[model samples]
Target: MSGDRLTAEVVFDTSVVEDPGDAVLAGVARVLAGAAPAWADRMVAWSPEPRERREIDALATLPDVVRGRTRWATQDRHTGNVELRGATAELNVVVSVNSSPLARVGGRLLLSNGITLTGLREQVAGEPRTDWMRAVFGEICAATRPVWGALYSASEYRAKVMADGPVLRALGRDFSRHLPGLFAGNYFGAPYVGLIGERVFERIGAPAARKAADGWFVDVLHDPFAWRDDDSVTRNADLLAELGPECFFRKGAAEGRVTRAPDW
Candidate 1:
């Protein structure tokens, strides 16, 4: 279910854009299409003005399009400043984009749901701010209501695991003692979350573990069995150096460095 894409209608407001050409809309559509389910289609505005309403028009004649002004509007306050109002579910998003002489594009995505996501691109500002534009669209795509049920279940699991913290740590130690090969190496490190609270002992004390997991290395580094030797402080320092200073560490934890193993 996590892999399944979301399905929804994507309606773009052409008025805020500098140009409402087909090419511009098509580029936006391309990125939006990637985040949407395979069945979703791009619905673009063919005309600048609203379509004429008919009393007896057939449903078949109507395009599968959202044909109304999103009630929200942006008022210019002063240079580099603007005011947004009427942002709600009934309104469409108000986007204001500015591409600069330095080839950087910065923009704000004001959603109908009263949420705003800002994007700034300095490294690579693609054609007509495409990179920033795609980021804005991705933010819009990700604006979903949280599933409280899932969150509650996850919280309960966390509580259960933490309630037996001591037992878990003992079990981890037993596993490490019986299977040194599974742990006691720089190849595997600890995770920031695992080192929180009393879990510092889980890494710095027994295993001499290094850094925390960051997505790709989550399983490898966070595995309880993947710890360093109790006396392998220098190895842990070397591992931290290899992992770079940017790796996440527990708050208030000493900065890692390449140093000799000191008697504990």
Candidate 2:
């Protein structure tokens, strides 16, 4: 059987201590280094019954996917695949951060930083379903949410933009500022901006209190209902909107469920 191409990107920016670009890179490294679910917990999740240890093997080799860079550039394809019940999904990730200096605000220097997580995946027929990617992304959320909270010590952060599939493609074309050849397939991202206190400046630190607006997109995707097989932009938007900023858990996809939609 043939395979279907699926790509996604989760892009966002939060207040970072010191350099914005460096901080975002550091944050992602920490997450992939077993910061979110913890290496031990993920090992267990990979082999719940102790015999299914393929993921364990994959986990040992995950470090290759965890990458960072100061400048925005096209990366050599870094691809890997996982079996997802009836399908084999191939995926790769690219992370980039750009920092912008802004005029001082509230008696402190203001900065506008950018972070982009671009990835491509192809789901081919025939395979055992797995949750490794979801698990990894969840860990990413766990790792970044608190940092966003601390960065935005005042007013809080909210997703200003979110896109998927063709809509995302169109948005990318319209903007045309993203790195050339950075996106492989349809993209998915949620961009935001926020403010933070000047006193909290450092390279890396412990997580702080979290807020509803912080990492809302990641929170939504972590839910089982985030993925769909259909190519309808309107439908996906409705699904995401339904999962609003305040909703952190699944509430049943009874209304606009796309049963035939492919899982991401």
Q: CA lDDT, every prediction? A: 0.24, 0.27
Model 2 C-alpha lDDT per residue in residues 162-224, reported as the tens digit of each score: 233345322111121221111111112222212122222111122211223333322222212
The true-versus-predicted C-alpha distance at residue 145 of model 1, in Å, is: 27
Tell me the tens digit of each residue's lDDT in model 1 across 1-264.
121111112221222223334333334334334433121232222222333222212212111122122222354211121222211211121222222211211322211111222212221122222233334333333332110001011122223222354553211111101111111112221222222223332344433432323211111122222133353434444544433423322222354522221111
| Model 1: colliding residue pairs | 184-227, 191-212
RMSD value for candidate 1: 19.3
Best by TM-score: 2
Instruction: In candidate 2, list every pair of residues with a backbone clash.
Output: 84-129, 85-128, 85-129, 86-126, 228-261, 228-262, 229-261, 229-262
